[model samples]
Target: MSITYLEAIREAQAHALRDDPRVFIYGQDVGAFGGAFKATKNLQKEFPGRVLDSPISEDAMVGMAVGAAIEGMRPIIEMQFADFSIVGFNQIVNQAATLFWRTNVPCPITVRLPFGGTEGGGPFHSQSIEAIYAHYPGLVVLTPATVEDAYSMLLEAVAIDDPVIFCEHKFLYYHLKAEKLPSEALPIGKARIAREGRDLTVVAYSAMVHEALVAAEELSAEGWEIEVVDLRSVKPLDTDTVIASVARTGRLLCVGEAWPWGGVTAEVIARVASEGFGLLDVPPQRLNAKDTPVPYHPNLWMAHRPTARAVAAAARKILRR
Candidate 1:
């Protein structure tokens, strides 16, 4: 049977709870409600007291996790929606993120965010918040696009003695699947070449990775070999791998579901232009969601986020330059 991206996450948490005595899950409705997306489905029943429910306050949830981690416990905090994470902005960026650096005690906390857009989620429910968390130091921001990465990276996040922002795309929870969970995975902070090509490179992460691959396939039909890079971790971005890909392709088009202003796409283009400027034949281009709050209507939502069609169009435009 095929395992989905959401199932992979549940399995990873089960593994962590089974193996680590200090590991526990705490969040709003996670214990009994199985999380907003059922990412914690039946985990409370399986683990019993290990999974606990908290109040609706995101700030309080993260604060408690930080305290628990300080006392030698590994706490996983689940944010129902990515946008709601901003409610705990202070605790995440200041308290949890700076705890270890300031006190020399490892803060092992994992915050799972059900990120990205689904049709009709609107501005409040649908937002790509990875770039915001990635801006801070002492926080490991992960964007898992595939089932394997969703499983393995989460396990790794629990193992690391640092605050981690696990950004799992809500759209991929049921849409993407793998034949089976992986026994091993690429190390964190590494980028995977989803599709190899020589004409141009499309650097993307999370849900956008699949879009990039689809764009690559579409372009391939027209004799354009497009390379797609899946950035597993944004904070510890693998610039070397991205630079190497750009060197071979001689063109770059960064794609993301987040808004254009200072998002991951902008970061990728900036890095390629600064570190690998000599490797490009044309100026690096990027495609992102419109610079407005995510829309509620299905048609507007579809137009708001980057898609296979938009990515392919952007790639073609960059290629022609």
Candidate 2:
């Protein structure tokens, strides 16, 4: 049985609500309209009052979730588009993420971001903003790639006691196909390997995981066996697994849709170079979007970001070097 990205997301929401009374969802068009991408489709009818349609205010939505978390309720707040999340930066970075540090009180909330490009969502709705929270001390960021992950990690995010930024690549939502998981998964700081090889290792998260896999396949066809590690948890990056993988392959290529300036790719490359340099055959390479704002035009947008071919090219060059 195959599932679409949007369908898997909705299934995860239902699983959370049914498994935990503390978990609930609230966001713009989340109730009757079923969200901008219909990820919350029919949830309002299924959960009734549990699924709420919030006002068109990201800040208020985040603050409300934070307040609820302080009172022992686990609330999952959805940003219709990841780009709109900037409006709630104060609530996220200052209030929600700092709650435990400030008063030793954990903020049990999840900020769900339906992020990434390929929808031609234009500049406003397309840019990946994981870098915005990359520097924040307490924010736990997680991105799910496959359908099993999409269905399970939401449960993990809801179970965590700290604030989480749950980013889902919108482009992968309906396009990807896979079997479903049983919907019981652990916390927000977990990573998994999607493919295994000994020649080179490609690390990525969210939609970039697919790109890495395609890149691996292409390289394999060319007699270059490449491994793909999905760094699902961006914040508490499993450097142990990444380092171990790099030790086996002796080469690494990190891929992400974030800007090249201060993206997740930069963080990954730095850690690999610093901690895993002894095991490397060549310098750690990274694949990221250009250091510019997302473009409105589709052709320019496609050219600006890293692709499967681009990742394969980078991986091959690193292997050769």
Candidate 3:
């Protein structure tokens, strides 16, 4: 039976809880309601006291998780929506992120954020906030693009001693699937070449990785060989893999679902330019969502985020240059 990206996440949590007694899940409606997106469905029944429901306050949820982590519990905090995570920004950045550095006590907490734009989700429900958390020093930011990565990376997040921002794209939950659960996976903080090519490299993560693959197939018909790299974790970015891809292709096109302002796309381009300037045959390019709040209209939402067509068009420019 095929396992979907969403199911992989839930299964990963189950495995973690079963393997470790210290692991517990906490979030709004995560108990009986099964989370806003049902990521925690039936988990409360399986794990009993380990699965818990929190108040509506995001800040309180994260704050309490931090405290639990300090007491040697591995807490998993699920934000109803990624945008709501901003409500707990202070607790995440100041408290959980810095706890280990300040006291040498590890904060082994994983915050699952269901992020990215969905039809009618609007600004409040749909947001790609990975870059914001990645900016912090101690936080490990992860964005899994495939079902396997979704399963392995989350398990890794829970096992990690540092606080982790697990950004699971809302768009990929049901749309992507795998034949079976993976027994082995690439380690976290590594990039995978989703599609290999010689003409240009398209660096992407999360949902954008799929879009880039679609764009690569389209470009291949036009005699353009496009390479697609999936950066599994935004923080601790796999610069070596990205720079090597650029070295082989000699052209780079970064794409992201987040806004254009200093997002992951920009960071990738900046790193490539600084560390591997001589490898590029042309100036690096990037594509991102428009600098505005996510719109409720489906058509507008499609236009706002970087789609397969948009990625292809952007790649064409880089390839031709």
Residue 282 in model 2: lDDT? 83
* TM accuracy, model 1: 0.99
Runs in model 3 lying further than 4 Å from the true structure: none
TM-score of each: 0.99, 0.96, 0.99
C-alpha lDDT of residue 72 in model 3: 93
Candidate 3 has its poorest 10 consecutive residues by lDDT at 312-321
- Clash tally for model 2: 1
Alpha carbon lDDT of each predicted model: 0.93, 0.87, 0.94
lDDT of 1 at 225: 98
Maximum-lDDT candidate: 3
CA displacement after TM-score superposition, residue 15 of candidate 2 (Å): 1.4
**Model 3 per-residue lDDT tens digits across residues 1-321:** 899999999999999999999999999899988888888999999999999998888999999999999999999999989999999999999999999899999999999999999899898988999999998889999999999999999999999899999999998999998999999999998899999999999999999999999999999999999999999999989999999999999999999999989888899999999999999999999999999999999999999999999999998877777
Candidate rank order under lDDT: 3, 1, 2
Evaluated against the true structure, the overall lDDT of model 3 is: 0.94
Model 1 agreement with the true structure over 1-321: per-residue lDDT tens digits = 999999999999999999999999998889888987888899999998999898889999999999999899999999989899999999999999998899899899999999899999999999998998988998999999999999999999999999999999999999998999999899999999998999998999999999999989999999999999999899899999999999998998998899889888888888888989999999889899999999999999999999999999999898887
